[model samples]
Target chain A: MAKVYNFSAGPAVLPHEVLAQAQSEMLDWHGSGMSVMEMSHRGKEFMEIIHDAEHDLRELMHVPAGYKVLFLQGGASMQFSMVPLNLLGDKQSVDIVNTGHWSKLAVKEARRYCHVNVVASSEDRNFAYVPAEDTWQRDPNAAYLHYTSNETIGGLQFPFVPADQGVPLVCDMSSDFLSREVDVSKFGLIYAGAQKNIGPSGLVVLLVREDLLGRARADLPTMLNYQTHAAADSMYNTPATYPIYIAGLVFKWLKQLGGVKGMESRNAEKAGLLYHAIEASEGFYHTHIDAPFRSRMNVVFRLKDDALEESFLMEARKNGLIQLKGHRVVGGMRASIYNAMPIEGVKALANFMQDFARQHG
Target chain B: MAKVYNFSAGPAVLPHEVLAQAQSEMLDWHGSGMSVMEMSHRGKEFMEIIHDAEHDLRELMHVPAGYKVLFLQGGASMQFSMVPLNLLGDKQSVDIVNTGHWSKLAVKEARRYCHVNVVASSEDRNFAYVPAEDTWQRDPNAAYLHYTSNETIGGLQFPFVPADQGVPLVCDMSSDFLSREVDVSKFGLIYAGAQKNIGPSGLVVLLVREDLLGRARADLPTMLNYQTHAAADSMYNTPATYPIYIAGLVFKWLKQLGGVKGMESRNAEKAGLLYHAIEASEGFYHTHIDAPFRSRMNVVFRLKDDALEESFLMEARKNGLIQLKGHRVVGGMRASIYNAMPIEGVKALANFMQDFARQHG
Candidate 1:
């Protein structure tokens, strides 16, 4: 039972309190004589869990009125296709700001239904930086302007919000959702795969403008069609009940930690601790993105001596640190300091990096 | 301290032993210092769990080597679309047998990609029976023929497999996946949403013939593409890890119960006890479906006097039998005797039904 820090970037570390609560309730949830997994989606006990989760998420994010919060399955990948299927009905084109991997996925899925206009991109620079707002070429008649608020893979984030300009904005906020405060009304839709900030892997939280409902194609299957889910309160089909229950538990955990504002300060402190260590390492470590656009959630960096990277990861694993391996496209290391990642873990990682640099340099 | 029986169809009951095992392993799975949900999909611990679950499923079903098992998300509702998106890549038509609500949804989704021909339908009779095989006029050159093995809503089941004639039979076996043994080689493909007979709802298990891989439209995202899953061993994306871990626990439970054959005999006994009680109650307690095509898993019945149905359910709930209310589409009582349902629960339900029937008569 030696200590271990899991940093796998979703399916990532969850709050220990959530796990303890789940363990205690696994066999008999709230004395119902059924595990949460065994309860029907339509059951009153489970419905309360779903309702409270949505309400907590809304309160945490300051989600405005006339917005529907849908607890969906299939992660953000499903929403990439579903967004265009629902919102791109009749509109033959949409504008996209391709900052990194997730937005590229969004653009690709939209291509199946509409012409995806590349409004701006950092791909030419190997996606090292998020583009400035002025660089985006606006599409006045496009169905929606799509962007990723934070790119998990490339470790880039939009420092500036796109000017609404009366056109709807949609963000795939999968990685950095609820980490900081944002104006929910600024975006027509916001979707996040729960694995990152919310709770677990199977559930997705979708915040859609009320007007976006019923815009889906008639032939879209009930699950993928946004209207069916919104109308039924995300119960059109048998939901991933166990995952939803866990997400609800995570919501409770977040509330007890004083909600999103408290999280913002905590996250900033953790990210600062690691980033400062990288800056001090100087010639030993190299970061891709410049200071301003660099993500506070995932800090991707490479070693000056590229060959030392594998040994670095191996040594880190031996030190009881895990999943520090960077994305395949971006080589080196990525420390995703999500909310559940304690500041102590980052301090330990920073200490390890400092010692490792002294020995290797 | 009060015991209760759960009879909800989907997101339904799980074996108590499996939940207990999961509870004990919630924080640290097998000394890995991470819950299965917290592990990286590519990590050794999680991969071993996925591998064993798939291996156990293959063994339990006696699946041929030609078929690949996919543990997917988005439930059967997403399958309604993915099935067509993958299989209808080159075809203009497909045959569908509408036994109940689920098959109807499949046909509707397929219609978006191809012209769906209703080969045979029991909808005219409120889906109380599986239409006769002789009445079917399946398309010879269609991409595939689809049907629902067990209609959870209507409690109807196909007693005999359709004559495949090598045309590729695809069955949505969601409600009755591992309730009993069957020759897996008989069908070209099969999918089961893991709620009833399996573990949980988030994971959809697909057993597809190898040749069906790589037929989807090239533009489909990697996650939706079954070929991508097959090539990567269903680890293309972060999977529903917790559910899969629980499914492996369920697989172990089934093995402890002597596999599907033993489950079949036990299921038969339980179903018989309940159905025999209904039949012996004469006209007072009536069943909706015809005899031969009745589902062995979900027994759908009603009271002759419709008003008595309300009291039957209320009294049953107070007596520790819960979620017996039928699906909205089929308004009555449905006692879903899934794998987790014991013979004693069935006996209790039957005893309650018999006593209530005598009072009404």
Candidate 2:
């Protein structure tokens, strides 16, 4: 079978090694006579899988003490509400930096539970760049300041971690989690849907400071309350067991390649290869986003002629490179080269872009 | 490796054929050069998988027109809150029948949003039987009448569908969904976690009457509201893709086995084999649940002497039967013979139980 380079935004490509291991263990995981999907969440075998996954992830991210890592479900969308439900304790509002699509979603969801103060916004410029730190209007008594470290749809990323003031910081790291190294202690909470950097689409990883655990609103549903999940170790109900097992395999894969730092280096090299091609293309291809804030994870760009874009996507698919189409909201192409995307795939994509540009220009 | 029968509840055994099929397709699904896990939810390929799953499920359950089937996350536990949040619109209270563990959980969660009037409860009898229908005190003006069709922990099932009587019937069919045929038109809403009769954990299927779609309270979070999912076709955000794919395979498997009627016959035969063994054992082995109310899915029982139960479990495991230990709340043994557990496995379990009783007695 011809190999293909998959670049679908989230629910994107996974490390081949992890899929191979999972395939081998599909019927009888570790000689347990049952697939991981068949094992009970409370069983010792499955428990070990979840425990090791958390440990490896914590080690990879250098997560500090007194922080709880929760493998949750409902994707990052659920957390937009859960964050406010669990953390808004007596606080009437929270601070938000609205960068693009994801941050807007967080803002809309948070507004259901609390007053979402727009501390800073890049929407005035169609969210092509992050607003400067100095532009943010601080909310001293807000519950927390929330932002997207990387906006996948708009192809913008925060170049610098916002300075941690005395107030806690919350982040949605769905697209770029573990793609680079970050100080875990800088944020009070970090959540990532597992489809991108982790493993699959069913599970989400949540890292929350211990102090944030029991402060959920009393009237919140048991499952919606963070403390119920934190206290029960994220198994208050049956978790996404099979997905957790696959993610554990991914964590092991990351560790074998030397953890998050190793991933960051490889990711940087891949992103550089593709971005260099875009830069070399001159006026044939264009990335309108500010250079510093152009996302390393999602490279969004437009071709010189709108008529040529469809042909470009069609040809790319024919050549076994898939999902290069951009978000529908933005009429351009987006190449999401996540952690599992190898340098060779990015090089092939860059070569294709160069060839396509020469023919179309 | 010794082949073993898996009996642990939720995230229990799936068909071996399903596991094999998933193994073969893990890396390159139907020559797409992408695992189902790696596909975007909006892509045609993954969309087909989700659509086929919902279609097969609808066909099997004989879901009527003007009903929407939603594939969701957070399991049935999340539905506890969602049910109230959605159905409690313009209503102050709802009637519930508390049969056991799962029903009580629903009651506790619903109370947070509405006055949950528990019209009937078997709690006084330790949930060993369904309270007689004639004795129920259901509220006439209740927004909806809710009940657990099958309680996994107590091994209790409602022998008869509760009378609708102009009130919308909402059922949590998590443990027994698709195990038997049901007239879907009778209930306004039904939800099942994809771990028992369905496939894997982390995914839930909700079938709601079309008219019931948009009544969710305005304050509900976007993800928590069922209407949000219905509007987006369950892709308001990235869904549990892998689990949904697996569940689709399960739907195909069910179709091959001749749908729910086929499952019912096989399940009845298997359950009969095991339940007959318990009844035939006289005083040695005992099932405290009323005969009519005993669950076809989870068969809960105990040995006369508590000391002998450990040895029975140990020898059973040595003989290749696993996960037979009962829940902590009711300490003995529970053999959850879901749709996937073949009759041979039930025969093996029954034979082990009879032989152990003969030897120990």
Top candidate, metric DockQ: 2
What tens-digit string does per-residue lDDT give for candidate 2 at A1-361? 5999998998999999999999999999999999999999999999999999999989999999999999899999999999999999989999999999899999998998889999999899999889999889988899999999999999998889887687799999999999899999999999999999998998989999999878888878788887888899999999999889888999899999988899889988888887788889998888888989988899999988989988999999988889999999987999999989988899899999999988887
List fnat, each candidate: 0.72, 0.87
DockQ of each: 0.66, 0.86
Error of 2 at A100 (Å): 0.6
List runs of model 1 lying over 4 Å from the truth: A217-219, B217-223, B358-361
The lDDT per prediction is 0.86, 0.91
Largest lDDT belongs to which candidate?
A: 2
Docking class of 2: high
lDDT of 1 by residue, B128-147 (tens): 78878888988888888999
- Residue-level lDDT of model 2, residues B90-185, one tens digit each, is 889999999998999999889989899999999988898998988999888899999999999999988889889888999999999999989999
TM-score of 1: 0.96
Which pairs of residues collide in model 1?
B194-B200
Q: TM-score winner among the candidates?
A: 2
lDDT of 1 at A328: 86
